[model samples]
Target: MDCLSLLEHVIVTLFLAVLISIYMNKGREEFFRILLLGLKSLPGMQGLISRVLKGEVTNFVKQVNLDETTKGGKRPPRVVIPKKGIPYDELREAMAKFKAAETNHVEGKIFAYTYTLFDEHFQLQKDCFKIFGEKAGYSENHDALVSLFHQAFLHENALNPMIYPSLRRFETEVVSMAAAMLNGNENATGFLTSGGTESVLMAVKTYRDRARKLFPHIKEPNIVAPITIHPVMEKAAHYFGLKVYHAPVGPDFRVDVQAMEKLITPNTILLASSAPQFCHGIVDPIDKVSELAVRRGLPLHIDACFGGFMLPWVEKLGYSVPDWDFRVPGVTSISADIHKYGYVVKGASVVMYRNEELRKHQIFTYAEWPGGLYGSPSMAGTRPGGNIAASWAAMRALGEEGYMSKAKELMEATIKLKDGIRKIPALEIIGEPCMTCFAAQSTDPEVDILAVSDVMETKGYKMEKQQKPSSLHFSILPHHVPFVEPLLQDLAKSCDEVKANKTLAKKGSAAMYGMVATIPDKAIINDFIVEFFSEVYKCN
Candidate 1:
């Protein structure tokens, strides 16, 4: 070999040797994380990465309706406070005009985040909020008079419950009711959170604090959970300075219990599982994992954010739900959202613990300040009394029968939809989903699901595209039952159309999806998504 070539080989070898030493001493995850810090410094890498990401970001922005240029329509005025307020009628007109910009989701084609069923039940919440806001309920003994307080409770602060005793009652009752539904024992206690994310954050914080008190020697604590666990858990780890070890899911899309157990090290502070994971809608093998958690003497948190309200009813309906609740001995905590299937208004959830001992870690107290011996539960202060009131009122009104009825209808609709999808020649359900939510992927190699999604969009369905095995997400609601047959027909036609040409897969954001699938480096995809978000939020 030439002298120059021989010297290059020797330098590269020595550098690799140093990297190996760092990996052995500092650990694989940290070593790679540190190495990636200087990724932009590598010759030609930054430019290539940026170029690849720019095209993908442009595609994503356009796909989400952020068109590059305005043509015919006038821009909405970005209004600050006017010197004179716009009259009430004019303000109402502006509100209606803004609202008109959205798709007619009531047609049942758009499978968005919320799946509200009834206008009547929705009115109950509106009345309750107005009862708090303007000054309204489902009390078994008497009509829950929410309007008694008027705007007084709406303006009231929940931080000092002594002054706002009714809001306190609403919050505690909502928490207690959720605990009872999840089969939490008498000693089991918890606090109300703004939503599922906050509940998860608090749960993670509580467990981390507990580990600090118990295992003070472990400075760098970590959490072990299924790869399919909600991203909120990742958010918690990021905020709380905890490392995460995500165990891979099995072919069934359930977390492999053995793989998860292997990831649990001495530094692992907690274990997490989802009742039905968000990505594929498959429940992790929590029963087996709970046994491992018990063996390891580690806290296990079941995130039932999606299935929280429905699964209890599913069990009641004899739908073969796996054991994943407080009935299990090793489950130390659970995060359940009332906002979703609970049919309440937005932003209400419960974070439960086996007992107050563990929950005490989640409580924050400040005696050093002039704030006069403050103690707050969860991460939120100045809590909304309206959310609490609506949650309480809705749960009381619905009772078990109301929820059970809705759950049954939703299950029936989901089954019908799943059956229909199975009949489609080119499409198949992604996993053995535990609940009403599921995803559909291409059974035929020629059929690109993302391409099918673009077609479905043309048919007025707001289909969410999935990765890992390209699919389209479906979250079915009770009211969606009526549109099941129509959706199935459109889906079948879309699949057939996409499969026939194959070149159609190259059109629109399907090209973006194809590019994302081929790219081996995930950091580039991360950059693409970040850029997409930046473009999406820029003043239009």
Candidate 2:
């Protein structure tokens, strides 16, 4: 297409868009009309429009990450390869500095990312990590990236278990261990996924395929889950060709079982809930939902990705957690992350079914390939053997006794943290969170929760802002055991600051979070999110 012709088409499109926007949103209509006016007399209007969009979108995105992902709102220098090779020592020093600059999760300064007990404990996992591969190669200095033994199986792949039997054993043993934690029966079996999202994806694929065979007449399968179901389920539904009916939660933030049942149609293939949903960290009424699933003759998938490893130990600590595992009569499948409460490295989760028959649906196979037979357990090809090994090693390093001891400290800290939050008159926890994780909201309207998050960031505390009720998510791990009181001090101070200065809500980054929480027009918020991410990914 020629430039002038493209410009003419754009003009026509803008005119039509303005006319449509006039009815839906008067403000946007006027704004775009001004843009169109600027487009009229300008030479090379295409470049002008491109610059306008780049300025508008990238600026908002960069501003959003100013205090978070980026420093001082300036784009970081792009990394490029060098013509001359740098010494391994120089590279090690550079990487060590970079690693040093990372958030000291050991000091409990951050939340939502690293999950660990102590610095010394995690170094063991790092040592095991070297058994597979490290980008800079193994260092002779043991202390460089934590004491490393010998590196072996550097070229190992999990795709063919026959080739590397250790990878196969590691994965299967991890699955077995995860299944036992969730109270799986003798027949319960599953596969290792990259993480919670992929685990959820596999569950969706498995249940969808199962529905095809059991209920062939139903062409359009759907899933019935609570509104609080993790966004991974949203991704799963979008990726798989299925419809989802989201039932609202009750006042306590637990999914209303009756509402879920009401949404279930004859074509509903699976019923879904979380073992403490992510945002508020409240366990959905899985027992009640499981009963509903049994009555409806539908498969129930429990997303224990966040709470899977935490809940069993929480129960062992004598907390009265609701039955969410295989002990629940109708629970069919579960996905739990070994990375989260399991205290392993990133990208490891297990999705297990009630029995082997249900798990078979998750496997993929092809016989007629020219490259010979092809078979995959999950979505990924050439699965990393390191992840499987690291996960297994972490599990062995922390046996049942070790996990229970960690859980005791973790929950005790959570109790202290919850008590401290309750003491703060302006802030209140959203629900009775099952694990050390919970979301907090502003009880007083004068206090802007997002602004408090901004202040908390300044105080060197990482806070994940949530929108449903203008709250903040705290994923307290063992790292937080000693810092509970200190975090609460900062929290109280941040809330007071927000209350004192009413203008903080309109300040940097908080405005973006506030828009999502306070804005009634979800359509506009959706557009902002789409544009924000689209511009973020565009090359500078």
Candidate 3:
């Protein structure tokens, strides 16, 4: 189209949008209420909208000290600090007030944080924080404290570990620990990265880079992964300019190994599987995929980020999990997160390979630079010392015995939660999930699972929702073991409330999710999410 026509189109669009905005603002109360009501009228939108609204209303009620009606409130939610620096004592008082305000949002109160906070353990962690935090904060050498205490002890960046001997040692130890956990032999070698996503990206990058080097005939590099593989692989493929081939999963939610085998082609560089996928927590058949990778001379990666730390202990505790780690013959690499189940502070994960030669492809090096020769093993250049230190501290504190015991408790809690959900006549658990994470689908198609989620939220339980099958999810933790009975009881009561009084669950984020799913144009939904992210970082 001509520039004139394009300008005319833009003006018309703007005019209509302004009219809609004015209408919406004029009927603001009606607009929001109806928007939520419309979402609840749809299936999955009810769950998402319900969660969001519950969060907003709960905060409103607490901050304003309002009753159920929210009438005649003295204070608003906004409380700002002074622009100028306060005296240390005044600052401490302000910090205490803020901490008190946040303390109300503690463990067993909500979900989504994922970490289990036991009363005794929470106190222990708090005390530990108080002790280590002050000293660490006051330390002269930022790098020295980090190097002394952290699990990944090296202060030097992994990008050019050769420049720093201590960092190289830390990196090697972390990788060795991960490989040993995965049943890798002497030949196995690996690298440390930021998190699970980076590990997955490097695996894709390594395979893609290797394909270009070895197979001159292959024009386009393609990766075949089960639908359950973390979205990171797909994202890496998009960013790195490679094609991704998805293999379907069985009703059990595990990857269909035969289907993946058939899909393998000359262009396929990496075969991917999750030890236990995110959605349903079902482990893919890595043995079959490993064999295929061997026959096809393709690299295979096992993503165990979710279940990594827990699974090792669970196996020791006597769970019949299949071999989905480095023990499997043709598996070239594995990615496992220490932060999640390892009870590490955060920002810790390990990516392992069969040999250092395979890992060399994952590294980025530069010989010519004004800043001198630069090389990084993973994505980030400057790593956080505090995170590394805290993670290492946490791991040492937990030890093998602590992890195993915690894993046992978590498994028991998961089983109890599963059983409780099964008893609810309206819902059916999706599959045999071996780990803490389990998903549920509504049997009565008319009754939205999101609606059930809304009811649960009012009772102070925050559950996650899922797409594709339209379900609600749970990720069990050690602290949850104590509250399993209460949680299950609440869930049962919520289910009853949902069935009897549909209006009770009629308000929240559930509505938004349901509405989004039914919308035929996914591009619009994607655009909305992207815009949401953009608006989040925009200056107020």
What's each prediction's TM-score? 0.73, 0.73, 0.70
> How many collisions per candidate?
5, 1, 26
lDDT of 2 at 70: 56
In candidate 3, what are the lDDT values of residues 98-188, reduced to their tens digit?
Answer: 3354323233453322243556865554445332554545343322222234422222233443323334444554566567667877667
**lDDT of residue 190 for candidate 1:** 89
Tell me the tens digit of each residue's lDDT in model 1 across 1-540. Answer: 999999989977886787788899989987786566556567998788878888897677557665333465553222111223233344334334533554444666554323454568765655555423332133322123322222223444567655445566567667777888888876788888889999999999999999998799989999999888988999999999998899998889999889988898889999999998888778888889899999999999999998888898888988988989999899999999988898766688989999988998998889888847788887987787666765665666567877787889999999999999999988889879978899889888898889999998998888888887788888887669899889999999998889888888999778998898899998999999899999999998
Q: Against the unseen true structure, what C-alpha lDDT does each candidate score?
A: 0.79, 0.79, 0.71
* True-structure lDDT of candidate 2: 0.79
How high is the lDDT of residue 456 in model 2?
A: 92
- Order candidates by TM-score, high to low: 1, 2, 3
The 10-residue segment with the lowest total lDDT in model 1: 76-85
